[model samples]
Target: MHADPRDARSVIEQDAMTWRQMLIVLLCVLLNGLDGFDVLSISFASPGIAAEWGVDRAALGIILSIELVGMALGSIALGWAADRVGRVPIMIGSLLVMAAGMSAAALSTGVVMLACIRLVTGIGIGGMLACNNAVVAEVSSLKYRAGAVALMAAGYPFGAIVGGSIASSLLVEGTWRDIFWLGAGMTIAFLPAIILLVPESPEIILRRNSPDRALAKINRTMKRLGHAALDTVVPIARDETGDSSGLFRGAMRRITTLLVIAYFFHMLMFYFVLKWIPKIVVDLGYEPASAGSVLVWANIGGVTGSLLFSYLTTRLPLRGLLIGVFAFSFLALVWFGMNATGLGELKTAAALVGFFANAGVVGLYALVAASYPAHLRAGGTGLVIGLGRGGAAAGPAVAGFLFVGGFGLPLVALMMGVGSLVAAGAIFVLRSPPKAPVRP
Candidate 1:
């Protein structure tokens, strides 16, 4: 009996998540957490780095934004590459790049050198995010897909929380260089796990190989995932032009466009808070150590918010849920700006702001993962995220300009609040297409 090549989703949907599947998701989460540390480490160390280098706010803003520029480029370039190459190779290679860049960043003599190194590091991060999101979506059952992505997204802020705590403690005796070294060390340590435990997406194997080869790969994966072997693996019909180009053609064009716009605004607000909060805390009279701790509290809120959003995904439509999250974020940002005068109030406000803001952003990740088919998943996600990095790049730099121009905290908060409102509106207009089975 000739078995038509089956969509990978059918295999995944039929099987309950076994240990192997769970482990894959867990590893992805851990990797993403490390990414959080690497990406946000500069924020934690910015105060010390600036003071040591005598870098002004505007210059420091450039330093902060440069990595995002690289991330934007990396996401598009590497993410598109992952559709053709395998996700695992790109992910592991990205980890190595991040490790090298972070270590080199520790030795930089001037801001320019550090900025260039950070750009390289951001590329790895961008590539890793695209791969990680695609892997999690492809590997998990549909029932658990949103939750897995949310959990993976939470790893970032969790890493930020951990990194902040470490940075706070190290600031007592160590310089900012010490923090970068630590990030590098942590990134290097996670590499072996990816090699040993994480498997390539089975869907990718199907798309890239001959039918016989694809069947063998899928059966092997199925056995490992604790599922029965198929008699035949059927391939889905696809455009012959290529998987990556399919993102902009036909129905995908609108979905891709709206996702980019929503993510762009979401990232703008999210990164503004992530990159600048520590400095803002210091400006409010907190010491560097105290600022780290405050940021930790904010990330704690981020973790909680991700988990909360994960729960909500089960009950609400993705667009409606996101709209509510962005709306709540706007209110929270406004409140935090106005009411966060005392230290206690500031911490509380930071937590609330992080909760709403981070959740909104991660929800977009889940939405993108769910919206696209397997063939274009990584590239589509990467393109949206890469384009979104424009907002991420702009957010801190614009904030820096405002800071230098004598903009007050309340005004800055109002600007971010406006971004949140815009993000909400963008997602509200986004129309999701029918879910496609996992196939190239």
Candidate 2:
């Protein structure tokens, strides 16, 4: 029987997400989950942690915000380093540090000890995110890139949900230390998989030596993926030829700054909402359990929105798509704050806000990938995403401070909408850097 060429093509495309690919995503997602567990668990466990340590409420917020400081710094620094050195080393090192941070948190005796550990953990999360954001975007085909990035983005909420669930289980039976131990344990789980399977960037391979080995590896991967007809894996160095260094030349500098700003605003609102929503609900006279449930629904909405929008981005003008989504997000936030005071309305809006906000996030990632050429893809990705991490890192800190000032949820959502609008404006100003004509 003769095989269909289309079938083979399908296999090759799907092979981009083969089990090996899935594991890379899964491990990174798990690392995200580990980060989520620690961050979310802190909020859920704060009362207990504060009580046990005899710390004041003000100090606890600082303790929780500590890791974010490290994360923001690590994200920018390590992301830059990945562009200079390589992704794998930075990622692996970050994972190891994350594990240590968790271990430290597990054994922390006072507020100071916990805060120190949280900072370490934040740094580790930052490093891992910076590298992974670049690697995952560059590794996949353009066809599935948005979906892959969005799916990864969804991991945080899922992880938070998992953390919350675990918190419920442990609230009576165990201490907050148990949550840290589990989070750390998960970090260790991914180390072996990451070391073995995550390949070096193909672009890096091409520039380091003759293209032969790189092409050979591509051929080998293709063959394993059941494709033998791929005559060339290297495109004729079109679209701003040569390496991460090339980003500093021509229009790249201006564009790079825009990307950095875009990412920062995108993360600002996203991280703020993610870290604080449950707390906000609790403050609104709901029980901890009820608040957790609302947050869980929002997270579910976020995952759904990410999946839906990611799929949609491949077919639409991705940048414009983000603008529209965020506009909808602004509208949703207004409605959520106004009409959602009742139980039913609040629940409905919780899901919508989660979906729209995360969907907007997915669109931001797609835009990041499309903004630059392949040579400096990782660095360009890192530069923008690292800037975003600044906001993500600052999110908890800012939100915690704002909550203390007696701000309501309405104002919080509106403020984040401002961040979304800023992102939309920056994206509007961008023109896709020159593209080569496709052969028909």
Candidate 3:
């Protein structure tokens, strides 16, 4: 039987998931994994950069956060582009920019040059992340969407785990430049994978393309996914489908604002942990290789937490579960600050912090996916993440200044942990989001 072209979203929501859909989700995971490694590559390499250049902690903090500034720009700009052009196209373009940026970073002669390259790399990573979230959500069955998104979110820590392990080994026998080289090669390798495998979102095609163009594209996607093709296509009006401009409309404006605030606070805490763990370990008198290992342990904990959260979503209410995760995350960060004295203690505490922090991250990913309407999904996610990155950028830089200013680790830890608590409070204030309007 011929299917209603407009019901394509319903098919994705109600029917059994096909391998094509699963492949798309898996690719999203890998892309997110790339984001993980690229973001932390500097973290893994920071000690060497500081040592080689004789840069102070305050300077180093700026270097650590400069890319996040670029990320903010990329997320807002590329995210809006993803909504306008297409998810796959923006993603493919992001990979190219990332590869080039990483390659340039490997050849940098000065701190200024490297920071500039890293900023460029952040632009690619930011755009890629915004697109990946939207693609995974749009393609999954409703029953499995949260789990799938959680799994995709898990890729961040998983990439950190794998990349950290390799980077630790590299640090033993190679200079920090080797790390960027590896990242560049990996980013280049994914270019072909995306081109050959991934497709544009049907919902996006319907909203943005002309009726004839939308029908052909949607049918091609449907055919690949093993679904029946439709004889006619009714293109969704731009106004009917909603857009980024609508994000601030009466009720949605409140949800968008609160969600962005929550994300901003949580990201501030999360990046503080991820960015500083390696440096913190190095300061404790361990070798850089060992420092990388400690960071790896954190990512290991992150993966564990993300997967567990994915499982729990199937059996529990997401809103309550998310708030609970944030509560524990705040405690874990404070505990890590206070009790991680010895190497063994440091590893254990890092893992605990990672567990809660990353789990909360997965929950936030799911929340963003569910909260926005279909058309605004990518843009909304990008807006939240882009602005939230202000916190991510601030976390490391703020901690650095605090360290320079004579604040103890415990006090700084307590201060950063407040981000998660504030995030939880924001989530609590937000009521159930209004459902998206149905297309005629």
Candidate 4:
């Protein structure tokens, strides 16, 4: 039988996911993992950077956060662009930009140059994050959507686990620049894979092309995916180039607002642990390599938690599940602050914090992926992440300032832990979007 293009979405919903589909999801995971490593590369190298430059916590905080600022802008800009132009283009371009920025970072001579380079790298990452989530959502079967996104989100920690292990080994014999070089090499390596393996999402084509044009394009995609073709095409109500303001329209306005709030607060909790763990361990008189090892323990916990959370997503209500995860995240983080004294204690504490903190992140990504309609998916995700990254950027920087101001670890951790609790409260009020197939 000739492939029918019109029912492509229904095929994705009702049928078993094909290897091609699974490959697309896996690609998203690998891309996200690379992004994970690039973002954390700074954390792993921070000790060496500080030692070589004689930088203080206050300055380092700004350095740590500047890339996140770029990420915010990139998520907003590139995410919108992805919806307009296509996800594949934004993703491919973001990879090249990331490679360039990482390469530049390797050659940076001063704090200013490194911060600027890292910020550029972050712009690439932000675009990738927004686009990758949308791709995973559009490609997966309804039965697999939640678990797939959870697994994709898990890649961040998986990348960190792999990258941190390598960084730990490298820092012993190499300088901080080597880390950026490694990131650059890895970033370049993904460019060809993305170009060859990923096709533009069918929904995006339908949105951007006229009914006749859309049918031709979508049929091409359907053929590529080995799905049946549709006899006719129906365009969605939105314009070819979707409006960003649509995110604030009617019921969507409230959903977007709540998602942004929840994400912002949770990121505060998440990045605080991720960005500070290595430096915190180093400050405790551990070698930089040992500090990196502590962070590996954290990502190991993150991988485990993310995988476990993905499993639970199939059985539980997403909203309730996220709230529960956030609550546990708060308790775990505070525990880490109050009790992490010895090396073993620090490793254990970091692991616990990573488990719950990253689980909360995976849940949020699942919610975001399921929250908006096809036309608005990437844009909505971008706006949420773009603004929420303020908290991500602030988490470490705020902790840095607090430490510089003489606040103890326990007090600072308590303050940071509140972000997750507040996030849980926000989730309590948020209703799942009517369009989402998952249980509310």
The Cα local distance difference test for each model comes to 0.82, 0.67, 0.85, 0.85
Q: Report the lDDT of model 2 for residue 291.
A: 58
For residue 18, give model 1's deviation from the true position in Å: 1.8
| Tens-place lDDT digits, model 3, residues 280-397 | 8888789999999999989999999999987887678778888999999899999999986898888999999999999888778778767877767656777888898898888889
- The ten-residue window of minimal lDDT in model 4 covers 431-440
Q: Give the Cα-based TM-score of candidate 2 against the true structure.
A: 0.79
Mind giving the per-residue lDDT tens digits that candidate 1 earns over 1-440?
24334555587865578888899899899888888888888998899888888988888888888899988987888887887788889999999999999999999999999999999999999889878877887788867776787788899899899888998899888888999999999999988888877766676787788878887787767776666677776674664324678888998898898888888887888888888878888878788888888788889999999898877766777778888999999888888889757778888998999999988987787777677876577667778889988999988888899889998888888887788888888777777632221221
What TM-score against the true fold does each predicted structure earn? 0.91, 0.79, 0.93, 0.93
Task: Indicate whether candidate 1 or candidate 4 has the larger lDDT.
Answer: 4
**Which stretches of candidate 2 lie above 4 Å from their native place?**
1-19, 22-32, 50-61, 83-85, 134-146, 205-250, 285-287, 338-347, 431-440
The local distance difference test score of model 3 is: 0.85
Candidate 4 collision pairs: 3-228, 3-229, 4-228, 4-229, 4-230, 5-229, 5-230, 6-230
Candidate 4 lDDT for residue 109: 88
Point out the higher-scoring one by TM-score: 1 or 2: 1
